[model samples]
Target: MKQDGDAAVNVPPCFISNHEGFRGSIKNLIRDFVVTEIDVGGRRVTAASANHTSPCASSDANSQSSAQFKQESDASTDCDVDATPPSFDLSVILGQSVSEELEQFVLTLKDETTAKQELSLGCFPDKHHRANVHRVVRHRFPFLMTITIQPEIRVREDPDYRELSQLVTEDEAEDFFRFIDAKVRGSSYTFGPDDSKEHRTAVHHFMSRRFGKLVETKSFSDQGTTAITVRLREQGRPKKRSGEERKEEEVYTGFTLRKENLETLEAISYMAAALGVLPSDFTYAGIKDKRAVTYQSMVVKKVSAQRLEEKAAEFQKRGMHLSQIRSVGEPLRLGRLQGNHFDIVVRDLRRHGTSDTHFSAANAHTCLEELVKEAVENVEARGFVNYYGPQRFGSSQSVQSDHVGLALLKEDMVGAVRLFFTPEEGDDPHSHAKRHFLQTDNAKESLAMMPLSKAKERLMLRALNRYGTGPDGCAQAWLSLPHSMRVFYPHAYCSRVWNEAAAHRLTTLGHRARRGDLVWRQEGQNKLEDAGETSLPQIHVVTEEEEQQGAYKLGQVLLPMPGNTVKYPENSMGTWFQERLARDGLDKCRFRVSSLKLNLPGCYRPLLACPCNFRYRLQAAEDGRGEVMGGSSRSDRQLNGQTGEGKQGSLVLVLNFDLDSSCYATICLREIMKCDL
Candidate 1:
C-alpha cells in the first residue's frame, strides 16, 4: 500500500504507527503554524525574550588588557616621525599644464559646503604617458582620487567578422572611428572577442597608465565582442580611530527575528537594504518556513542596536518584528542552534474514511480528543519515518528542484539552465520573462522584462547574455549565483535520493539496527556540534555482535545520500543505491563536479525522528473564535476569519513539540494524519 503523496518524490509508503489517523488540513492560516528556534545553549528564543547584555560581557580588567594589547600592536606598525612625504610634478607626466585645476579641486575639499569634487585630467591615448600620470598622482598627491572613463558600446546589429574583413575600406574604417569619437568623445576603444589576450592586456595597461592605479577594468562579452569598462573603485578610506576605541567597538549585533509569511532570506534582504548593508553581512542558524510565524536568532556585523530599533516600526508593517537587540562578540553561524520548537494547529479534524456526520454535536469533542491522543501517543513511542518533507522538493508542482540537480549531475548544462528558468503555472511574476527567453532566445530582452525580485532568474539571464548557452557559459551562469542558492539544486537532488533510500530501507528491512547498517560513533556525534551544517558527520558500520546485542537503536541507524565519499549500507540496500543512481544516469564518481567545485560528499541522516516535549490538545474551534497559542489576538482573528468560517464546533488538534535541527514536523504530522499533506 503506497502512501497518498509518495508518487511525487517516491517516499516510503509505510507508517510506524498502527492507530487510526485523524483527517485535517495544516497551515490553514499563517498563525496556525508557529516555529521558535532553540539555541545551542538549550534556550528557546521567543518574541518577548529580550537580552540587553552583550555576549562578550567580561571583567573591566580583561577589557583594559585587550585595549592595551591593541594599542601596542598599532604602535609597532607606526611609521617613523621624521619620514618625509614624497613630491612630484604632475604637469610633466600629464604633458599639460593643469596646476590651476588641481589647486581649485583641492580648495573645494576644504569648504564645508562642497560635498564632492572631481578633476578630470585630459585623456592620454599613449600607454607610456598614461603610466607616468598615474605614478605621479599616487606618490605626489596621496589625497586625490582618480578614475578612467571607458566609452559605452551599443551594438546596433550582430556583426559577421568574416564578412566585415572582406568589405573593409579606408573610408569605412575612418567612418567607424568617427562614430566612436561621436559616441564617447574619443575617450576609449572597443575590441572584439577574437582579439588576442596580449592585445587585451595592452589595452588594460594603456587605460591604467592613462588614469590611475585606483581605476578598475572589468570585461564582459556582448554580441561576440568583449566590452571592457574602466571606472574608479568606490572604496573609501577607513576612519582613523584610537586603538582603545577600536578594541571597545562591538563587532556584531545579535537579535531575535520574528517574521510571518516571509522567507528567511526575504526578511534578511529587507533588513539589509534598510540598514545600508548587503544580505551577506547578516548570518543565522537556519532557514525557516515561509508560510509560518517563526522566531529565530540572527546576527548582523557592524550594525547597532539603535539602528535596528529605529526600523522596528517599518518591519512590523511588513509582518516582521525584531527584539533582543544587543552586542555580541561573534556572528551567528549556520547550525549553531540545537533545534526548533513548533506549535501547530491541525484544524477541521475528522476520522479517516469518515464524514462530519460520524461526529455528532453531542460527542464531537470527546471522539476527536480520544483519536488525537492515541495518534500522538503512538508517535511519542515509535517516532515517525524521517523523510524529507514536500517543501524540500519545492513548492512548484510542474518542475522540482531535484530535476535541475539531475541535469547538472549528468553534465547537461543547457538542460539545467532551462529547468531553472522554467516558470510555474498561473500568473507567475517571472513567467513573462521566462517565456520570452524560451521563445525568442534573447536573454537581454528577457532580463529587462524580468522583475528584480526574481534575482536568481535575472542572474542566469545576465550570464546567458554575456556568456552564451554553451557548456562553459552555462556552468559560469550557475557559478554566478549566490553560494547558498547554487548549492540548493544539487542538495535537493541528494535529498530526493536520500528519501527514496530511507523509504526502501524501512520497507525492506524494518527500522532496526541491521548488521550492515552504519551508525555514528559516540565521538562522531560529539563532532557534529563543531562541524556546522555543511560538514559531514563521522560514522561506522554496525557489526553482527552489535546488531545482536541491540547496541544501536533505529534512530542511530544512518542512510547515505548519493555522493563520492559516502559509504552505502553493506547489504541489499547498498545495491539499491547503485541501481537508483544507474537509473538516474549517474554513478558515484559523477557526484564530484570539479569545474563547479560542487563535490557532494553527502552526509548521513537518521532513519527515525522522535519529537521531544511532545504534547497535544483537542480544542473546540468555534466560528470567529479560533485561537492559536503563543500567537497574537490579531493573528488569531486572521486565522479565524480564514479557517473558522463554517467550521464552528469542529475539533482542532493543537500539537506542541520540539524537534532536532533538520527534522521536519510535517513528517510527524503526516504519520499521525496518515494522509497526503
Candidate 2:
C-alpha cells in the first residue's frame, strides 16, 4: 500500500497471500482497492493497488493555482499516473494455476498453524510494531509514479570577429572559423553569454549593424593589412621610484615591433632604422599598417630632446616624420587604439572625365549622401551589446551562454515562488514551515530577486568581471549575489561548479577579436572623474573648426540687440540657438567643419562656435560595451525643414583619435571607414 496522496508501493518478495485480511486496519488504504494473484514458478505472488488521497492542504499558493487550473481546464494531467491500475489477475502460468493437487500437498506438508505464524512475521516484522514497518515501507518504496526528465542547455551563435583584415575573401573567412574551431577542439565556446537567449539576441544585434564609417572606406583585393598606432593614455605624472629600485635596473629606452594589420608600424620601424637605431630598439604600443596611416607612441630612454629632434629630421628624409616625442614614460602593450578618425579622398571622378568640367556633380552628391547615411545608421545600430566582447575571450574560444542563463532562470523561478508566497499575514505560517522543512532561503530570498532588471545587471557584472578581468575571478561573484549569502547559509549552494564554470571560461579567454580590429569613440576634453566618477571615458561634443570660422557671421544675425535683450528659452536650447542664427543676414552661407573628439561615456562638453558664433558641445557617453548612452541631443538633431538637415555650408578637416587603455580605436575606425589605415 502507498501513503496518502503518494503513488502505489512495490510489492516485496515476502508478502503473504492472506495479508489482505488485515487491510481494514490500514486507514485510507481501502478506496477502490484491487488485488491480483500471480504464480511465479511454484510460488504464489499478490499484486495490490497502493492507496492514494487528495492533498490535505494547499499551503503553497502556486501549487494551489496549478490544481485550480487543472480543475477548470479539463486536461489529462493525471493520465500518466493513473493509466495502469493494480487489479489484474496473473495467478495462472500458461493456463495452469499451481496444480490443485500440488497445492493440496504443499498445504498438508506445511500445517496451517505454522504457515500462519511465518506469514505474520514476514508481513508485520515485529507484532508490536506493525505501524512502524508499514511507515518504513511507505517511505522507502515511495509509491509515486517515477518521472525522468532530461534538461537541455541552450546554444548561442558565436560572436563575429570579422574585421577589414579578416575579410580577405570568402575562403579566408571560412578558414578563420575552421582555425578557431580547431583551436577550441569542439569545446563549445560562448561569447561571454549569460544565457543562450541573450547570446542569440546579441548576435542578432551585431548582424543588423555595420562595423565602421562609410565615406572614407576603400576595398581591397587581397588579404590586406593596415597599420594603426595605439598611444598609451598619458599618465599625468610619473610614479616615484625609490633610489634602490632605480639603481636595480638598466633604463632600457625602446622595444621591438611585431607584424599585424598595420602599415604605420612599418613606417615607424623604417624611421627608427634610419635614425641609427635597430627596429628592435624602437618600442611601440602596437604594429600599424604599411599602406594606411597609423599613429602611435614610441619610447626612447637616455636620449636628449635635441637628439630626438635630430632623429625626427632623419626620419623625414626617409618619407617618415615624427610629429612630437614626449618622455617614453611606459612600455607600450599590444592591441591598444583610441577610436580612429578618417579623412578619405576618393578620386577617379567616376562621373566626369579629367578634362570635362561640367559633366556632372551627381556622383559626388550621391557618394556623399551614401557615406553619411551609412555612418549614422551603423553607429546607431551596432554600437554595443554590453556583454563581454570577443576580445575578452580569445579568438579561438566560444562561451556557453546557456549555462549562465539557466543559473539566472533558476534564480528567477525561486523568486517567483517567493512572490506568490507573500500573503497579507506576513507569512509567519510559511516561515515556520520553511524553517521546519526546507531550512533554506534559496526558494525565498535568493530566487526572489531574479527579475530581468536585477538579473541582467548581475549577469552583466559577472560577465564583465569574468571576461574583463579587472579583479580576481572569485571576487566577481560578490558583484552578482548578496554578501550575506556567502556565510554558512543558503547562498553556499549558489556558487556551484556550473555557476563558477560560466565565470571561469569568462576570464581566461576574454579576448574575442582576432587581430587588427577595434571599437571607436571620440575623445572628450575633461577627465572621467569630472563626470560623476563614471566608469567610461567622457565624450563631449566640440564644434568643428569650419563652423567656428563662420561664427562671427552667424553671431551678427542672432545677436542683433547684443545686450542680452532676450535670454535663450529655458526649454528651447536648440530652437533658441537656431532662431538666433536665422536672425542674422547670412542665410545663404555655406561652410563645413569636421570636428573630432573622444566619444567617452557620461561626460558633456560644449562645442565653440567660430570667433563669435555660439558654441554647442556634444554629450556622448557609452556603457561597458562601447554603447552610446543618452539619446540624440540638440546638436545631433539634424535640421530637417523643406530642404534638409545637416546640409553642410562650411568644410574643415581635423585629424585625431582616442583609444581606451587596452583597445585600438584606430583599427576599429579603419574597419568602419573601409580605409587603408
Candidate 3:
C-alpha cells in the first residue's frame, strides 16, 4: 500500500526499506539491516541490505550486559578491600624526632612568604621539600637512616595528695612502744619470758644480735618490755650511781629530732609535712650535708610512735633507719648535733686516652659543683619558698601512658574516672581498653559518614594550587630530592596522623573527660544551681619570653594557699598555652635546620654500616717528592712535644629542652643519660 516515495513510511534517515512484501518489513524491524533499491545510470534497479550494530535492543540482551558490568565492579571492590586493613601495630614510640619533622614540614612551605600558602603535589619551600625527602628515606631505608626530633614538653602536678595520705597501710603503721625502767637499782638484769632458761637465752641473743658491738649492758629485765642497764665508766674505771635526783625520764621513752641545724631541720620538717607525717616522726639529729651521706635521729609522737616506727622500718630498706630513740617531752628540736659522714660510689665510666679515670671524676666533681651552685641560686632567686614538688605524690613513676591518660581525662570519659589508687607498674591497663574499643567502633561508623572530610581537605588544597599563590607543596616536594637530604624531615606526616588518630581513639573510646561539672541554670530563681565536683584546677603554662615573664610576675604575687584550691581552672591551661604560642611568633617564625652529629669512638676502622666518614691518608709519592699521610706522622707532633690536634673520643651530643617538674628531673635525666650508643 505504501510506495517508496511515500512520506508516510517514516524510517531512519540512514536507511530506506524497499521491501515489497509484509514479511520483509517485519524482518527489517527484527534484524539491524536496511533494505534499499538503487538505480545505476538511471537504467537498472538493484536491491541491497546493509547490516550494523544497534544501540537499542531487547530486554534480555540488556540484562546480559548488566550482569557483565556487575562482575567487573565486584573485582574492583575486592581489590580496594585489601588496601585498608582493620588494624595496625607499630612498636616504636613516635616522639621528638617526629616533632622536628613537623617543624621542617612547616618551614618548607613555598608561599610561606605570603599570608597564605597552597598545598599541592610538588611546589614546596626548601624545608618542606627536605621534610618529604626525609620521609621517603625513612620508608626506603629505615635501618640505614635515623631521625631525631625535639619534643614538646609540659609539666603537671598530681591531685591525689589528700586521698593518698589518709589511706594508711598496716605495714606502715606502728606498734606499742616499751618504756625502760631505770629508777630501781637492780644488781642484775634478765630479759625474756619470766622463765629462767628462756630469760638467759633471750638475754644472750639480745646482747649479741640487738646491741652488737655498739653498746654493752650488764643486765636486762623482761616483763611486757625488756630493760637493759648501761655499765658506765668514769676516768678509766666503773662508777657507782648516787642515790639522788633519780629521774624516771632518764629511762628510754620516745623518739625526737636528731638534727642540730635549724634551716635543714625546718626543710626536713616541711618535707615530712608534704609526706603527711608529723615533725616529731621525721626526726634527724644532725643536718647531713646535701652532698654527703649523713645519719640522724627522728622522733615520733607517743600516740603515733608505733606506726611511725613501722614506716621507719620501710625507710630502712632504702638505706634509712631509726638508729636510736630518745625521750624529748616537748617534741624534737633542731640545732644540737655533729657533722655527717658520706660514702660515695661511682661506676661504668668512660675514659679518654689522654685523661685518666681520675680526670673523669674531677669532671663529675666540677659538674656537681655547678649543679649545687645552680640549685642554691634557684632557691635564692625564688626566696626559698616551700611548695609541693612532683615526688610528693609519686608522679615521677608514671611513664608516657600517664600523659596519654591525662589527655584522655580532658577529652575522654572512661579515662576521667579510671582510678589508680597506687603507683604500681601497668596499673589498670585494660581500664581504657574497652572504652577505646567502643570508640573505635563508633569512629569507624562516624568517620565513614564524614569521608568527604578528607576528600574536601584534599580538594581544597588542589583548588588552592590552581587559583591561589603562596608556598610550594612542602608535603610532597621532598620526594624529588637526592639521597643525602632525604631523611631531613622523617615521619612528619605519619606522626601527625598517628597523634591525631591516638587522640581521637582516646577521646572516643575513653571516658568523657570534661574540664569541670556542667553549668546549671537556676530553677525559678536567679541563683545558680549546684554543679558536680571535679578534679583540681590545672595551672596555666607559658614558655614564650614575654608571656613567661608575665607569668613569673604573676607567680611572684600569688602566695601559696592551703590545700589545692587555686585561682584558675584546668581548662585555662590550653587558653594560656595558645597565648604563649602567639607570643613565641611560632606561627610566623622561620627555622634554620641542621644535620645530626654522630660520634663513633673506640673505632678500629670505619665500616660501611656507619653514617660517618673517616679521614683518609696518602701514601709516599713515587717521584723525588715525599707524600705524607695526614701531613706526615712526623709533622703531626707540634710544639711542647704535643700534636697540633689532640685525639678526641667520639660522642653524640644532642641539645634539647625539657619542661618538667623538679620531681621528674630524674626521669628526664635518665632518658637522656641512659643512651649508651
Candidate 4:
C-alpha cells in the first residue's frame, strides 16, 4: 500500500554501479492532493510495443534488450583496487650496546644484501564464469646480522568509512561521479528506485483550511439557466413529425454544485440515490476534494427541469443544491468539462527560513508572504513535477490501496482480497468489523452483522459466504465487486509505477534529453506514435544541446504511465521504468489478465506541469468560528448565495487558480510553501 500520506520516510539515496551518487531529499507536506484534469481529445491511444517485447526487457531485440542490458551490467561489475603495492623495504638492528659499530655497519647494508619475495593475491570473482584478475607483488627481504630487532608497535586511529569512495584517492572522487553519471542513464543503480519519493507536503502548524469553504459558479453549453423549460429546432425537420408533436429525445441538466466538507463521490451518490439510479449513471469530469468546498459541474441524464426543481429541497437537505441548471443534448462523462476553479484559503500563516536562517514569529508571517511570492514566481516561470496526487490513491492515512494493486499484479488472490477487505490505517468501524468476521468460518453470521452502509463489503461477503470463503470463494467474491473497483487494483499499481518512474527520470536525467533518451513528438497529433510496425511508440532522438534546451522548457519530455500496451522510452529512463516493474515483482505480462482486462489499457502523463492562470492573495485569518457561518448545510439553509459573504482574516493566504486536468494543485502549493501542505 502507498503510505505516501504520512511520508514517514526520507528520499532514499540513488546509487550508480553500486556506488552512491548525488542525492536529492524527499518532501511530504501537501494534503488533499487534488487533480484538475485538463481535457485533451482522448487519452485512449497508447504507445504500442514491439512484438512480444517485455517491459522487463531493456533493448529492442526482445530478450536481446534484456540480454544486452545484462552485458552492460556485467561490464560494470569490474571493481577497482583500493590498495596498491609500493617498492621493497630492508632494515637491520643490533641488540648489544657494544655492537654499536656492528649496528652501524649493518645499518649501512646495501640493497644487494636483501632477498626479494614475490606473491600473488586475488579478489572475489564476478559473473561466476569470469575469474578475478590477480595482482602480483614483489617485496625485498630485511637483511640483519647478529642483531635482535623490536618491531615498532603502532596503533592506527581509523574513522569509519561512510562510502566506498572513501578508500580512493581524493583525486578519484570526480572520476567516480563522472563514471556513475555516464553509466547512470542506463544502470539500475543510478535510476532504479529503491524507495519511492514522497510528494506530500506537511501543513504549516499555524495554517489550516476551514472546511465547508466551497464556493461555486456555473455555465452551460446552451448558455441558458435552469432545465424547467426546453426548446427544440428539430434540426431542419418539421416541428411535428408523423402527425404527432415532436418531443425531446434526450436531456442534459447541467448545474454547478459547491458542497462543503463533502466528498464528490458521496455527493454524486446522493444525487444518484435521489434519482433512483446507480452512482455510475451520472458522470463527472474529475473528483474534487472531500475536506473543503470544491465547485464542479454535474449533468444528470433523462431528468426533466421540473423534476430537478422539485428535488431542490432534497438536494439542499443532502448538503448540496444545484444552480444554473440547464438542459442540453448530451450527458456528462468523465473529462467532459474543462478544469476546476479553486478558491482555496490556507490559514494561520507562519514563517519558516532555510537551513541557514531562522525567522521570528513576529516577522514570520511577513517572511512567509514574501516567500510565497518568490516561490510563485519560480513556479510561474518553470513548472512543477506533475506527480500523481494522494487522491489518486485512496485517502486512508495508514495502509494504502496500492498494495492491493501490486497483489493483483502478482496474482495473489488471497492477499488481494485480504488487503481489500481488512481494516486498514484509515478504515472505518464497518470496514474493520467486516474484515475481522469475514475471515472466520461464520462468514454468513458476519454478513448479517454488517451494516447496509457497507454495501460493497456486504456484496463481496455475501458472495464469499455462498461460495465458501476459500481460494475459489475469494476469486468468485473478487469477481462480484464493481468493475471499477476491480480495475483499481491494477490502476493503483500503475500509478505507483508512474510515480517512481517519473521521480527517477527527473532526478537522474533532469529536464534535458540525454543521448539515447527519447523525446516526445513535437508535431502531428502531438501524440507519441508507434515507433514502427509492432514496435514501441514513435519518439524523437535529440542532440545533447537540444536536451539542455528541453530541460529549460520543462514538459519537453514524456513520462510513461505503466500498462499492458504502453511502450516505455528506449533511454536510461526506459531502462529504469522496466527495472522498476521488475523490482516491484510485476511486468507488462501481468497487466493482461482476461478476468481484469478493464484496467489493462494504459496512458501517458507529462513529466512536468506548470499551473496556468495561477494567482494567489494573502489575507489575515478570521477567528475559527467565523469561517463557515452563513453557508447552507445539510442541517439548515443558512445563505442564498453559494458562499457566505464574509472576509477571511488578515492571517491567511487565499489562493485561486485554474489547473490543467490531472495536474496536482498541491505541487504548486509545495513549491510555494517549501514545506508540508
Candidate 5:
C-alpha cells in the first residue's frame, strides 16, 4: 500500500498556486487534426521540414529539396476529398455517430451485390504515445537549445522522392518511362517495381492490401520486392582523405526492410547487435506493425549501402528482406513523413451470413465491394474517434503496467519498485526470470539472465540484487533506465486520462460544448503549443456557444490533459474526468516532481477525429487468393455468428486511407467496423 508521506511529497510545488491572476485559457491543437492524404496534394516531398540537417555529401540533393519545397508549396493540393456526405441514405453513419436516430441499423442492411447478403465487420488498433514534456520545458526559460550527442531512433527521409515518383498511387503504375524521366539523381539506379518488366507481371498479387492474412494470395515471386524501396541519407564518419581538395559527400543509403511478426524495435536491436554498434545507431520515422508484413526506411551510421547489400543474405535469415540498396546525403528522422499510403485488405464478409448460406459466386465480388464502399464513405464524412491506441497500456510484458510510472510520479518509491520488480507468470521470461531472482535475493543468479538486451530493466534489478530494498536503491534504479523508456509509462497514463476526457466531451456535448462550458483556446491549427511553457495563467471558461463559432470545426473542441498547472473545466463532464483520475489514485496537481526529467503539465487534444483522403475499394479476390478462415477458429466462429453464406473462396474489401504520424490508423478502421466505442 502507498503511504501518506509519499502522497504529500508527490504534490508538485506548483500545485499550491491559486491560479487566479488571469482567467485565460491554455490553447491546444486537436490530436486528430492530422495531415491527411489530401494534404499531400501531389506536391513533391522535401527536406525543408526536417529536424536537423547534417553536413553531408551532396549539394544538388540539398538544392533540389529546397527548390522543390518552394515550388511545391503553392502546387500542393488536397487529394479527392468529400466535403459532405453523399445523398444515398447517410442516416446509418450519422446515426452511428450520435446513436439516437437509427431507423437504418446494420440489421436492415443487405449486400446488393451477392443476392442481398448481410455484412460482417471487425475493428481499429495502435502502439503509440507522443510524450508531453511541457511542464519541464516551462521551468527551463524562453528557449534552451541543449544539443546532446543524442541518439533517438526514428527515420526522417527526404519526402521529395516519394512525392516525385508516380508510385504514390495504383493509377500511377501505368507509365514506367514517365516515372523514370522525372526521378531524382540516384533513383534511376535504385530497385523499383518498374526496374524490370517482370516486376510488373504480378503487381496485383504483391499489392500491400492483398498480402495480409485475411487474403492468402501467393506473393508473385519477383527479383525485387516493394520492401520500402527508398534512398535515405546516412550520417557517416568522415575519414580524412589525402586528396588535393578534401570534401564531404552526403552518404546516401537505401534503407529497406521487409519482415513479418518482428517489430521495428527488435529488428533494429538485432541489426545493431550484429553490427556491434549501439542499438541507438538504428533510427526510423515510424514503427511498423509487428504482426503484419510492413515495410519502412531505417538509418545506420557509417554502414554503406554496399556493405548492407553484401550481408543481405545474412540479414534475410533474421527474417526480413532488405534490398533497393542505395545511399543519399540526408538522414531520415522521426515524425517526418507526409502520410502512409495504406492498402489494407479486410476479409470475411460472407461470414456475416445467417448460416452456411447461399449466394452467387460472381455476386460475392460486387456485394463485398458495395458494403466496403459504404464503410469508406462513412469514414470520409465523419472521422474516426481519436482514442489512444492499445499499445500504450501494458499487457503480459515486463513493463507490466504504466502504473509504475504513475507511482514514480507520486513519489511512492516502494510502490514503484514493487510494480517494477514484481514478476507475473506467463510474462516475458527474460524479464520475469531476472526480477524473480532479484526479489528472491539471488543476485548472482539474476545476472545470468540479465544480458545487454535487458539493459534497461537490469539496471534497476542490478541495484536491488546488490543493495537490497530501500528508497535510495529504488530511486537509483528508476533513474538508471533510459530516459525515453522511463517517460513512456507516465506519458501513457496521461494519454489514458486524455482519451477518457475526449470521449466524455464528445458523448455528452454532441462533440461540442455549450456556452459557459470550459473549452480550450486554439494555439495553432495543428499543434498544442502553450502548455509546454512553464508559466500559464488560470484558464477561462468558454462563454460563446460552440455553434456560435462554427460547432463543426476541428479547432472548437480541445480536452485538457490532467496535470497540476492545468485547471479542470468547471462543468459536470470535466468533474467526471477528475473523479476518474482520483479513482485511478492519481492527482492532477502531482504532475510536477522536480527531480524527474519529465512532468505532464497537461495539454489538450482534439475531442473528435476528422480524417481526409479517406478512400476504399472492394474487389473479388483473384482466383484462389482470398479465403475466409472465420469458421476454423473458435473466435472466428464467435465473430461470424452465422457463416458461409457466400462461396468458399470469397471476396475481400480493400481500405485505403491516410492518417497523420501521431494518429492511429486502427482507430479509423474501428470507426468503420462500428465496434463498441
Candidate 6:
C-alpha cells in the first residue's frame, strides 16, 4: 500500500477504506478521464452547456446606437464629451464678443488641413478666464489641444495632440513602459508639452490604448516645452477590413475552454499564439490535468469573442474548443472555482480473489460492482486522507520538484540551478543542453543547444549567460521564469511537507478533531486556493474544551502548510512540523526568500475530503465496448478518443463524483483502488 514517489517526498502509505480493492488501470484513453470545472456559483461548466449565446455579447445595430447615445449623454453630463462648435456653450464661460471670436477660431482650426495649426487667443488678463478657455477647448473642441502660456491660451489642431493633456506620473510611465516591453512589439508612446510630465505620461497611455503596439512614440523639447510624437513603427499597421474596429468596450472575454491531452497552460499558450496575445493574458480558476479531457472557464483581457471565434479552426486542430465567448467584467483568478466534477473510467478491472483464476464476464462485472459500491460507501462515510497527488511531486524519480524547492528554501542557488538543469532519464529534449551546461559550465553554449520549446530553460540560460553563474546570476535565472512556473518549486515543497504532516497526523492522532488542532474559522471561507499561494485563510485553533465537547468533527480539522507567517498547532503535530522542517534543513524563517520576492505565508487544508454526488457503474468489457456514465455525450466521448473499446474479458468501472476545490481526484482514486497512483 506504499505510495510511489513517497520516498522522495516522505508521503506515507495510508488508506481510510478497509474494503478490498481490485486491479484496474485508469486513463487508458484520454476520454477515460473527463473533468468539468464547477464555478463559484456551483454550476458545472460543460461543453454542451456552454454553447448558448452569452448575455454580455454586443447588442444589435439599433441597441448599439442607443447605447452610444446614452454614453454620449453621460459624457456630456460629466463634462467629458467632445462637443462641436455648434453644440458648444462657449458664451456661458466667456463674454459674448470673446466667445464669438473663439468660436470662429475653432471653426478655422477645425477646417485647417495642416499637420499642426496653431492660434493664440490674445492674452486673457484674468487667470480664471484662461483656465475656463482651456476647459472649454478640452470639452468643446477636443480636436484642438490647448496649452496655456502665461495668461495666453494657445490652441493647436494636431491629431496626436488631441486629448494629450491628461496626467500620468513618472512611476506610472515606467510601469507602462515595462508592460509594453514585456507584452508588446513595435509599440511606443510620446507626450505633449504642458510643462508637466504627468500630463505627458497620461497622453502616452491614451495613445497606447488607442493604437496598441501599432505605433511608437518619442518626446523632444520644442521651444523649452516638451512635446510627444506618435508614429507608425517599421512594421507598419496591420491590414484591416473596411469598417472593422476593435471593440474598446470589451475589457475581458469569458469563454469555455475545452482541451484534450494538453495542460491548461499549454492549451492557453496555443490559444494566445493564435490570438496574437501573450499567454499570461489568459486567466483561469484552476489548472486541469493534462492527460484528461477537461472543460473549464477562462478569461482573457482585451480579447473579443470575434477574435477568438476567428481562431476556431486552429483550436480544433489542436484538440481544443472555445464556446460561450462573451464579455466579462473581470478576468478569472486562480482558485475561484467551487470544485470540479470528475467522470473517470477505470478499465481492465480484475477482481482480487484467493486464487488467480479468470472469472466469467458476468461474475466479474457483478463482483466489481459490489466492490465499487462498498468502496464508495466507505468513502462517503469515512472520507479519504487528503494527500497531495504524485503529480504534485512530479513524475521524475531522478529528481522531484520538492528537491529543487528544498534547495531554494535553503538559499542554495547554485544547488537549485543545478537541480533544475539535471538531466532526466529517458529521451528528454532538454537532456543534451542540460548535460552540455553541466559539463562545460557554459550557459551561452547550453542555451544555443536548448530547444526553443523549452522556454523556461532558455530564459534561465539567458539570465545565466548574461549575469554569469554567480549567486545573483543564479537567482536572476530562477526568477526569469514566469511567476506561475517559478513559484511551483516552492509550492511543491510545501505540498511535500503537508503530505508528510497529514500522514503523520493520521497515523498518530487518528482522524479525529483534537485539542490545538486548527479549523477554518468560517465554513466555506477556507480560501486555500492554488495551495495557499495567493492568500492565507482565516483559521481558529481547537481548544481543549471544544475538543472534549466534540464540537469539531474530523473533517473540520485542518493542518497548516509550513510558512513564515502561519501558526502551527499547539499539539505534537506542530512540534512534528518543526522537527520535520529541521530534518530538511529548513525553518519557518527560511520560507521567506526576500531577495526573490518569494514569500510563503502558508494556509490550512482539510485533512480529509469526501466525494459529493458520488456514483459508480460497472460494465462488461467482453465485447470491448464499455459505456461511460455521467454527463459525457457520445460526441464528447469520441472527441476524447473513447471508441467504446477497451480490453476484452475485463470489467470497466466508471466513477462520477464532485470534489471540492483544491482536492485531488487522484488521491480519491488511490484510496478506492488501494494502489500507487
- Model 1 Cα lDDT, one tens digit per residue, 36-71: 887754456776743322111222333323311111
The C-alpha lDDT values of all candidates are 0.64, 0.25, 0.24, 0.46, 0.44, 0.66
Which tens-of-lDDT digit does each residue in 158-180 have in candidate 3? Answer: 11211212222211111000001
* Candidate 2 CA-lDDT value: 0.25
In angstroms, the error of model 4 at 28 is 18
Q: Work out the TM-score per prediction.
A: 0.64, 0.23, 0.19, 0.56, 0.54, 0.64
Question: Per-residue lDDT for 416 in model 6?
Answer: 92
RMSD per prediction, one decimal?
Answer: 24.0, 42.1, 41.2, 30.3, 20.8, 18.5
Expressed as tens digits, the lDDT of each residue in 1-677 for candidate 2 is 21112211111111101111100001111211111111111011111121212211113334323321121111111211111212212112101242232233335432645332111112111111222222222222222111101000111112243331222343433443433322321232222212244534444343234321111112122334321111111221222346243321223343222212224434544554455553334454433333333334455444444666667555555444454444433444332222112222112111111233311223323443344344434432332111111222111112222223222223333332222223233344433433322234333242333332233223323443354422332234323332211111111111121122222222322223111111111222222221111122222222344234432121111111111122221222324334533444212212110111111111111110111001111112122222112232232223112211133211111112212222223222222333211
Decide which is better by TM-score, 4 or 5: 4
Clashes per model (N, Cα, C within 3 A) = 3, 78, 47, 37, 30, 2
Q: Write the per-residue lDDT of candidate 6 for residues 1-677, one digit (tens) a residue.
A: 22222332344787877888766667767877888887754456866643422211122334323311121101111101122222346665555676677677766653546333555555442222343455545555545556544324556654543333224444444434333323343454454355777766766677667664466566778788887766554433432436465455335788888888887766776676668776667888988888888889998876777887788778888889888877555678878876787877776666554334433454643565567777777887778988877777665567788999999888889899999888876656678899889889899999999886565678789999999898999999987765666677998999998998888888898867899998755332222222111234457788899888888888767898888777899899999998999898885455877767787877788898877656565544436444442233332112222324343354566677777778888889878876665
Candidate 5 stretches greater than 4 Å from native: 1-258, 300-313, 320-334, 350-370, 394-400, 417-435, 438-444, 450-470, 476-480, 516-542, 545-556, 563-570, 588-596, 601-603, 620-646
Cα RMSD for candidate 3? 41.2
Residue 201 in model 4: shift from native, Å? 65
- Name the better of 1 and 4 by TM-score: 1
Q: lDDT tens string, model 4, 429-458?
A: 776565667467566777777775455667
Q: Residue-wise lDDT of candidate 5 within 4-88, one digit each (tens)? A: 1122111111110111110100001111111222111222122222231211112233332332111111211122222221222
* Poorest 10 consecutive residues by lDDT, candidate 2: 16-25
**In model 1, which runs have C-alpha deviations exceeding 4 angstroms?**
1-10, 49-251, 273-276, 302-306, 355-361, 522-538, 588-590, 624-648
Instruction: Judge candidate 1 against the unseen true structure and give its global Cα lDDT, from 0 to 1.
Output: 0.64
